[model samples]
Target: MATLILVRHGRSTANTSGVLAGRTPGVLLDERGAAQAAELPARLAGLPIAAAVSSPLERCRETLRPLLDARPGLALHTDERISECDYGDWSGRKLAELTEDPLMEVVQQHPSAAAFPGGESMPAMQRRAVEAVREWNARVEAEHGPDAVFVMCSHGDIIKSVVADALGMHLDLFQRISVEPCSLTAIRYTRLRPFLMRLGETGDFGSLAPRPAKESGADDGRAVVGGGAGAP
Candidate 1:
């Protein structure tokens, strides 16, 4: 099996606008997002990336652009399975307004039962994304080698779901995991089990230092419908 470098696409216009942007066609990276994309080359400088895959969405593609430019020889492929969760009628709607929807609570705490009125279920989303990774892992190993490392640029929820699968967590619990825009998560797969090498690495160790705890909040457990705007 190969090492997987899971990347959440850089922050996008929708991200900052508080829209869900689920499978939205025209959502592109914002200014800070472009800067984050530009940093990809240096972020994984030493790894011999074997292959690259991205969600068939503009934001994900734009996020991988700088890295692909730096590695001209690495071919980039698009997989729809790893695209953002189909938010159905919720697509393009503001997250704040969605908070009032009854289904939002199910999405926050028991995502396994949450399904968009016109979209896919959370479990289905996880299954497809995990399947794509499995197929890619075998393909990379056959074409490159077991020790090969590959990168896949995808949406925040998709990346979080993949990480949850890698850690043997249920889809309902996936929302507890978060990956900031342009964050990198690494996983190593073997015949026995997958190892999570890193989770949400933004190259900011200062963020790891102890911080004062705030008062318990009402929305503390709510997962941002779309990954919320990254650290500001």
Candidate 2:
């Protein structure tokens, strides 16, 4: 069996502004996100993280700052397969504005195969996301032996795909599971089956995590949903 740690990116400008940001370039993490990133290392203190993998996106890379700062010796492996689903024309658009698009209709009725006007199909996204983690798990077990601990930094949808896969839920139900940003999830797997050790648990992988400050209103760092790995 292998122990795996999954982390979603920190809060981005897109996140705070309520934009979809699917495969959008240079969206980057904001100041609060940088602060949030710094807190991760402490949360992961004492944990033996053997390998770190990340999605091939700017947001995902910025999320790696905390984990990398905590473990500079760890090399980051970039995986395109772990990237957020391409939102195509909808990329960088606000959610409320997107609600009226015809694309959402397809997503509502046939989520698994729902393809945005120019976005990726849900089924394809789910398959690749699941494969990204499974492939990494296999590699970790093979290279570092069966008990190796690995960390993965990815996007919200990708993390949901992983949880849904682990729980044997339908691909279309991705929105049902709420994985918070910067939250960490741990999955253990053997030749027989896969088990969830932690689901949408924040402050579990990186070391030296500082407590997040309180927000003015209801927008404090409280978990919004299990939409991603670790939504800190």
Off by over 4 Å in 2: 203-232
RMSD to native, candidate 1: 2.6
Off by over 4 Å in 1: 205-219
lDDT of 1: 0.89
lDDT of 2: 0.75
Could you say which candidate leads in lDDT?
1
Model 1 poorest 10 in a row by lDDT:
210-219
lDDT of each: 0.89, 0.75
Clashes of 1: 0
Q: Write the per-residue lDDT of candidate 2 for residues 66-111, one digit (tens) a residue.
A: 7797788989999988898887788877765776677675665557
Which residue pairs show collisions in model 1? Answer: none
